[model samples]
Structure formats: C-alpha cells, structure tokens
Target: MGACPCGTGRDYDDCCGPLHAGVPAADAQALMRSRYSAYVREDADYLLRSWHRSTRPHALAFDEPRPAWLRLEVLRHVATGPDSAEVEFVARYRIGGGSVVRMRERSRFLREDGNWFYLDAVGG
Candidate 1:
C-alpha cells in the first residue's frame, strides 16, 4: 500500500503493516492505529485477532456497502496501568456514495502476553 490507512503519514509496511502481519503492537496507541488500518483494509481476521478474547465476536461480516474510511484523528491516549490503557479518536467515513459520517469513541485496551488487544468501547 502507498500510505497507511491510520493517517500516520507513514508507509503501510513501516506502520500498521507489521502489526497486521502478526507482529505485536508496541503500545496501546499502536494497536489502536493498527485496528483502524484493519477496518480500512476490511481485514476482519486481523480485527478479530487483535480484539480481546472475551469480547471477540464469533465472526466478522462487512455490510454490502462498506463504509469507505476517510481519515482518523487520535484525540488522546492514556495508560491506565501497566497493562491497560485507553484511546479516544474520531474516524470519518462514508457508505457507498453518501455523506461523510464522523464516529467518536473512547476505547479500552489490555496487554496480555506482551500483545495488546482492543478490549471494548469505554464510553460514548
């Protein structure tokens, strides 16, 4: 890919690519970025894999008219503990040829076995 879908201003291979390829994320923010890239790439497998086991879904199915991811803005990243953290972000995307929609969320993450996983949405 040319640029990373996570809006990192970096090449995919130098950014989220490694994480998608099974390399562990360096931190909660890194994992959050990789997860955003996964959505853009429509890589459900990676998305499931990077999710916390307790919350991972049985399967991932994209809608017929998948949202075309536009950009991502990471508002904040805070470590709650040695193995837990949170990320707040806004992601813009559109479905088919529709108006852009902005989604904002604060997400929690947990590190286990030296690998970071998306835990869940912390708040609205």
Candidate 2:
C-alpha cells in the first residue's frame, strides 16, 4: 500500500485505515488525521461516523469538481480540557488540474465513551 494520506509516512493499513475500518482513534489528533485520510479516499461514511452526533451533517456529498488531496500538514494538537481537544492542520489539494489550495483549520473534538468525535472547526 502507498503512504497514508495523512502524511504520517506509514502504510495506510498501519495508520488511518484501521480507524476508517471502525477502530477508534487513540487521540484527537489521530482522529483528525484519519478524517483527512477519509476525505482523500472519499469515504463519507467514515467522515460521518467520526463526527459528533450533535453537529454531524445529515449526509456527506462528495460532489463533482472535488479537490484531489495532495498532502496534510498537522501544525499542533492540544488538549483544551479533559475530554476536549484541538487540532490545527493545513491540507493541500487541487481541483481538476487547478493550482493547489491550502486549507488551514483549527478543529475541535470531543471524547465520549472513550471515542473521539470531531465537533467543529474554529477557523479555516
């Protein structure tokens, strides 16, 4: 298998693949990386499953003209509280041969029942 889309320099099976396959992520940062990999793979089910129920969308639509994920750069991961955390990352992608676009976001996550779920993003 190729390198993990999260840029973790590991095979997908040893990295985010397991998370997408139903294994819970160990931390907020790990969940965030796995989410990025889900997007790269167009795995909407994984994305939805990792989202917090309170804020989860009804559905995820990877419509046409979707950007092809190129790389992920995790900037920082910090615990805001005992069960809350934040992950800041820059994801680079391009749409249909267009120039690369960088999306920088500080995403919040919550842990419930020992499972990490993405809450929302603060800035992008």
Candidate 3:
C-alpha cells in the first residue's frame, strides 16, 4: 500500500482516501490532512468540496509542471470553538527538478452540518 501524503505514518487508504471518497473528516485537523492529500493527488473537485462555500474559488487549474508534493508536517491544532478550529502545518513540494518549497500556514476551518471545511490561512 502506498503511504499517505500527510506523513501520518499510515497508508493512503487508511488515512485520507476515505475522506477523499466522500466520508467526512472527523475534525478540523483531519480535514486539513485530507485537503493536503487532495492537493497531492491534484483532485481539484475534492479541494473545492472541502473548501468553505463562500470562499471557494470557481475553478482550480492543476496544469502541467505541477508540484510533486513531498510531505505534510502538522505543527499544531487548536479548537477555537465548538465549530471552529485552526491547524498549523508545513507542506513540502517540488516542481520538476527544482528545490523543495516549504509552505507554512496556520489555516482556519469551520464545521457545519457535521462537516468541516477549510476557511483560509490566517496570515499566509
């Protein structure tokens, strides 16, 4: 089995595949991890679905020269309220043979109707 992109030391199917397949994430952190996996897979549909409706973009273009996602390091997760949370993470990726790019962000999430959706990054 292939390893998960989220660096959770788990297989893809056991980690984020179910979430990508329409099973709701258990919490904000889980949703964040699943979203990272979506990016790795270039699954724009899953990305849009996991994004908050109000802030979701109309489309995503995963054209050629796509970054090869390396791994995800979750730094911290905090529950701001019963239905809101934040997750700090660092995702590493590389485009073609270029140096790896590390993207660090503290992202917010909102839970509605028993589902968690990414809102946006705090300052990133």
Judged by TM-score, which candidate is best?
A: 2
Note the residue pairs that clash in candidate 2: none
lDDT of 3 by residue, 1-124 (tens): 5998888889999999999999999999999999998898889999999999989999998989889999889999999999999999999999999999999999999999999999999864
- Cα lDDT of all candidates, in order? 0.95, 0.96, 0.94
Q: In candidate 2, what are the lDDT values of residues 7-112, reduced to their tens digit?
A: 9899999999999999999999999999999999999999999999999999999999899999999999999999999999999999997899999999999999
Error of 2 at 77 (Å): 0.2
TM-scores for candidates 1 onward, in order: 0.97, 0.98, 0.95
Clashes of each: 0, 0, 0
Off by over 4 Å in 1: none
TM-score of 2: 0.98
Residue 15 of model 2, lDDT score: 99
Point out the higher-scoring one by TM-score: 1 or 2.
2
- lDDT, residue 31, model 1: 97
Candidate 1 C-alpha lDDT tens digits along 14-114: 99999999999999999999999999999999999999999999999987888889999999999999999999999999987899999999999999999
Name the better of 1 and 2 by lDDT. 2
lDDT of candidate model 2 versus the reference: 0.96
TM-score of 1: 0.97
Off by over 4 Å in 2: none
Q: How close to the true structure is residue 60 of candidate 1, measured as C-alpha lDDT?
A: 94
